[model samples]
Target: MADLAKEAASLHKAASGLRTVRQHTAKPLQEFESASHDLSALGALGSLLGAKGDIEEGMTTLVKLAKQLDEEWETEAKFMGDVSDAFDLLEVLLTAAARAEKG
Candidate 1:
């Protein structure tokens, strides 16, 4: 009967030790879960920054196209003005030639 009692006490001590080990193991797992959440949030932030960079690139492209169009129009306007002045000078020269032939 004494031996039976001793065995039961040993089993009780072993069970308590197991519970303590489980408690210690669970703390690290909880810390790992928290770190996992932080890493996931950082990944999402990185993706957002990449999207912002793409938008900036698109806007820069648009600005460059707009400036190119403005320069083309400015050059076209100057060319048209020069053509108009040349036509006017040619008409005046033709008039002078006609008057000189009359004499």
Candidate 2:
């Protein structure tokens, strides 16, 4: 009975650890931590049989990271396009002025 109590206590600790990992962390910063807990929960079915959707939750974190990357890429693309167009206009203006002086 004492051994069973110790086993139960160990299970409870693992359960508490998994919950802490899930509730306390968010994307990017908690990515690795969430993964570690998820894998542990997978190995121990007793702790994670109900939260099977955590894998999808992990994917959601990745989706957030992807969205952030897309936003940055779009910002960079717009800035580059604007700069290129400005240079084109400047070159045209400079050429027109040179022609007028030559005339």
Candidate 3:
């Protein structure tokens, strides 16, 4: 019973740490999205200026790369959310264990 309590405490600590990390992760992702939007605006301006075909193509490639990066970050965010859900489940289990121990 004491061991279970220790394990629950450890898991709670880990879950809190993960929540902090996840919050920090969001800031950079938002910054990246903002930068991507700025780059897309630059790409549009370059098109309006009649940039050389090769230069336009390069800009397009960069935009695509930025989009890909955004997608990857979104996937990572989803994974983090899933991990958070798992933590919630662990917390629930811990609560049940404590209740059973009391009973």
Quick one: best TM-score, which candidate?
3
**What TM-score, computed on C-alpha atoms, does each candidate reach?**
0.47, 0.46, 0.50
Q: Report clash pairs, candidate 3.
A: none
- Model 1: residues >4 Å from true position, as ranges? 1-50
Candidate 3 off by > 4 Å? 1-51
> In what order do the candidates fall by TM-score, top score first?
3, 1, 2
**Between prediction 2 and prediction 3, which has the larger TM-score?**
3
**Least accurate stretch of 10 residues (summed lDDT) in model 3?**
33-42
Best by lDDT: 3
Colliding residue pairs in candidate 2: none
Write candidate 2's Cα lDDT for 10-88 as tens digits: 5445544544442344455456645645555465573457554666576667766755755555565555555545555
Model 1 residue 31 lDDT score:
62
TM-score between model 1 and native: 0.47
Query: What is candidate 3's local distance difference test score?
Result: 0.60
Question: lDDT tens string, model 3, 1-103?
Answer: 4554565556556545544564565576557545644554556766687654555466557656755765665566556556656666676788899899999
Q: Report the error of model 3 at residue 99, Å.
A: 1.4
On lDDT, the stronger of 1 and 3 is 3
> How many clashes show up per model?
0, 0, 0
